[model samples]
Target chain A: MVRQERALRTREALIESAATVFDRDGFSVASLAAISSLAGVSNGALHFHFSNKAGVADAVEQAASERLERLVAAHGEAVGSALQMLVDTSHRLARRLGEDVVLRAGFELSRDHVRQGGRDLYRQWHAWVEEALKRAEGEGALNGIAPEQVASSVVAATTGFEVLGARDPKWLSRRTVTRFWQLLLPQLATPPVLGSLVAAGGPPGDHARRTPGGSPAARAGEEDD
Target chain B: MVRQERALRTREALIESAATVFDRDGFSVASLAAISSLAGVSNGALHFHFSNKAGVADAVEQAASERLERLVAAHGEAVGSALQMLVDTSHRLARRLGEDVVLRAGFELSRDHVRQGGRDLYRQWHAWVEEALKRAEGEGALNGIAPEQVASSVVAATTGFEVLGARDPKWLSRRTVTRFWQLLLPQLATPPVLGSLVAAGGPPGDHARRTPGGSPAARAGEEDD
Candidate 1:
């Protein structure tokens, strides 16, 4: 049991290290030696767990996928409409991408040609958005706009935030995303359903931290771009 | 005069070669030797033209900026609404991105952290969109939607398509972009002005090749994504 636990922890550490390097240098130029060293693991151990750099990237993608799944699941169980859940998920995701290097790297690596056959996180996320929108439609929560169009817009905007945040971390701030939702939700929701959705991003709890523009008043210890 | 012309041609060739390399291998990994060899120029000649890799990137960015300037100017002169000009420019820019390696490379290099203080094409483009939307507002072409909000959506979607197209060229195709505009214009244009906008992208002349999905029907000569 002790050995098993140690092995799992080592794997997690290596994946995190690989994500850091991949995120910094991009997948094509990132090296396994850098990843292993960053993880503080031996060369032999790095090889024993993953065959190569692609393997390490796959592990990172897998971890990120699991994390995303958990995030979706948690938000999916929201008490109100699925549309609200979708909006909350987008806000939560923007926050996660800001804070989590592994999550960001998962997206970056998925775009790289080096990791052929690895999970295409972008497509997966897009499909998930579509599903959520479809559920919203079924619930009669959507307005006159087609769910696909809304899904495309949401996916594009969220994906754009991730890409822009790569250079300017401010793009991923809650305020920026909130502003995005603020403009979009009005058009997306019918007059009857409009009151239920939170354009500031999340439910009442999260609204306190995220203002209309998405600026957090005094949140400290957050890393800069 | 002949020698001066030769030098100018060599400089242009070197910059083109550098763009191809930088676009393919990225800025950090691209080698100056490869660029010189690809241009069929001597190492001394290449160095004489540009001091180093950053210099080469700067040259490429300058060329791309010129191209973008010409494109924006051509579209900006439209006799109709500024909103229409904005739409036409997006279509034209998307097309240029598909065909122009230097333009695409300029954007990629701008995103790269190594090329700090290089021309931020994304910011430049974003600012341009804001200006165009402002013009639209001045012309009363805009609906009730905030120009800033519309600018954000347009910039994010256009940028997203460019980034997505890097991996799957289809995302950058004329059809995909046209569909984007088709979905967006209804929300952007005032009721009286909606009829004037071309959701299929550009004026009738430019729409000859593009279908709804961007599939090229028998244009064998055109480059595939």
Candidate 2:
């Protein structure tokens, strides 16, 4: 059991290494050597954990997804309302991923999974978004559109926005989310009564102690972008 | 003068080569040798045109930007309503780039450019969106919200939906475009003035018979994703 646990730890290390390399530089630039270097493992040991780069990528996706699932549950449970929970959770989740290059690397894994004909993890997330939209509808929180269409659009919009956020921190942060709430709030049946729409600090913070715009990692620690 | 013209042709060849290479294998994986070979030019000649890989990328960005500028004007002039024009043009543009890896590569380039610097090339497009919203508001076509906020939200939502279309062809189609119109129509300035919105087919295909989707060079013609 001890040996197996150690082996598992080593595997996790390699994945983190791979994710960092992939996220900082795109997949093509991410080399096995760099991955192993980041993990502080011998190249041979890295290979021992994963036979190929694709295997490493798969592990990264699963790990990131697991973390996201845990975050959703934890934050969801803590909040007073589901809608508030989602907004706060999105803020927190984006912060976490923005801070850690490995988590951001998960996006690449997602793209690769589609190219490789693997299980669509994005579809799984889409289902979750749909389920949430359905609940919102039941609570009279949605516009006239069907939950199916709205949910799919939300999923796409959210992911697309995230990609845009990753690329254009200034335009997106300076305007994107603020604009998002404008259009979306009207669509919702009711705005969450709990929490102010504009929260200060930690992504929602000011430039004195925090900035809403910067590289993902830097902004992760500051105000909401 | 002949040498100058030859130089211009060589530059064009290099830019086209960069687009093709970037389209097939993505930006980073594409090698200079591959680009040079595609251009059917010697390595020295390729270097003469573009000082480095970055130079090639810069050239591509300029060319793509010019093309996009033409597109922005084309839609603005051909269609009277800015709001309807954006959607209609989006559908057509999606088709234009759907199969042409070159156009897609252009999208990829501008995204990266925005990431590296806060240049305002694309910002102009957002400004136009804002202008449309305010005009709609003045005409009493807007919901109860600030026009600037509403316009920003609409643009973000539209863009958010666009990312979906790029990843999954089925997300945006003639039927889907109609659906989008239906959803946004109510939000418009007096029911979108129905006569103003044009259908998928434009100008009756009298010029060069360019297919609705794919590059003009495609063999089998265009097909929806």
Candidate 3:
């Protein structure tokens, strides 16, 4: 049992290291030797866990997808209007993306045309956004627009944030996501629903507590008009 | 004058050929030899025109930007509300993206991390969207929302469409762009202004006639709802 746990730890380390390398250098230029070296693992151990660079990328993508799934599931469990859930989830996602290199790298890899055959994080997120909007429509949270139309815009905007955030990290900042919702929510939700929704999300420290040593300070103090 | 004209034609052919190869194979795997061969020019000729592959890519990006500039300028010439101008320009740009390989490849290359120091097409589009929204606000066409906020979402959504369309061409279709405006225009335009706006854009073949041998036929028949 102890040996198995150690193996798992090593694998996790390697995945984290690979994500950092991939995030910084991109998939085409990132090297396995650099990844293993960063992880402080032997070349043999790296091979044992991942057969090749593609394997490492696949592992990173899988790890990121699992986190994304958890994020969606967590927001879904909360009792609220689906529209508010969508807003809150987007905020949380932007924050998590800022703090987690693995998640960010996974999203980046999903769009990298050079890489092949991995989970498409954007598509998965788009599916979730679509489902949420459909639920909101059933609840009459939406004004009169079709749920699918809103889904396309939401997915596109959020995916755009991710892509733009890669170069300018500020694109993933809370102020940016909140500003987007502030503009969109008023148009999307009915009068009552709009009043009930929090475009700025739950609270500053709502999800920050979950990530130990995660600095919320870096994300604060932006003029949010 | 004949020599200069011939030189211009050769340069244009090389840029067109490079865009085709880059679109199909991506920038990393695309080769100068293949580009020249596809252009039916000797490699010595390719070298004469471009110092290297990056030079070729720069030319493609420049040509694409010029086409985009012309599309924007053409729309700006028509006397209309700034909001409608924004809508029409978006439609024309989407159609151009679908038919024009150089334009499409230029957008793809803009987001490519491997390439460096070229005009950012998204930023240029975003700036234009911002200016138009500001103009609409001045015209009292916008319903109290800050133009900058709307601009951010619009830019993100449009950029998202461009990025998503890379994999699935449907995202860049007139129908898809029209659907986006249908959802957004109502929320964006003031009540008096909304009635005058056309979400489906000017007319079929309005700008499609400009592209020689272009097929608007392939783009037709998608359900608008």
Q: Which candidate wins on lDDT?
A: 3
**Per-prediction TM-score:** 0.87, 0.72, 0.89
Model 1 lDDT, residue A177, Cα:
67
Which residue ranges in model 1 land beyond 4 Å of their true spot? A114-117, A143-145, A205-209, A212-225, B205-225
DockQ of candidate model 1: 0.29
In order, what lDDT does every prediction score? Answer: 0.76, 0.56, 0.80
Let me know the DockQ for model 2.
Answer: 0.22
lDDT computed for candidate 2: 0.56
Give the better candidate number (2 or 3) by lDDT.
Answer: 3
Candidate 1 lDDT over residue span B1-225, tens digit each: 999999999999998899899888888778999999999999999999999888899999888888887877876464478887887788788788988999998888777764664678888899889999998898888776667767877888888888888877877766566656655665677777877666545555544556544443311112122
How does chain A of every candidate compare to the true chain A by TM-score?
0.90, 0.75, 0.91
For candidate 2, write residues A74-155 as lDDT tens digits: 6444433444444445455445555665556775556531236243545666776677667656755555456665555455
Task: Evaluate candidate 3 by giving its C-alpha RMSD to the native, one decimal.
Answer: 5.0
Per-residue accuracy of model 1 over A12-79 as CA lDDT, tens digit each: 99999998998898877788999999999999999989998878889999988888888778754645
Arrange candidates by lDDT, highest first: which order?
3, 1, 2
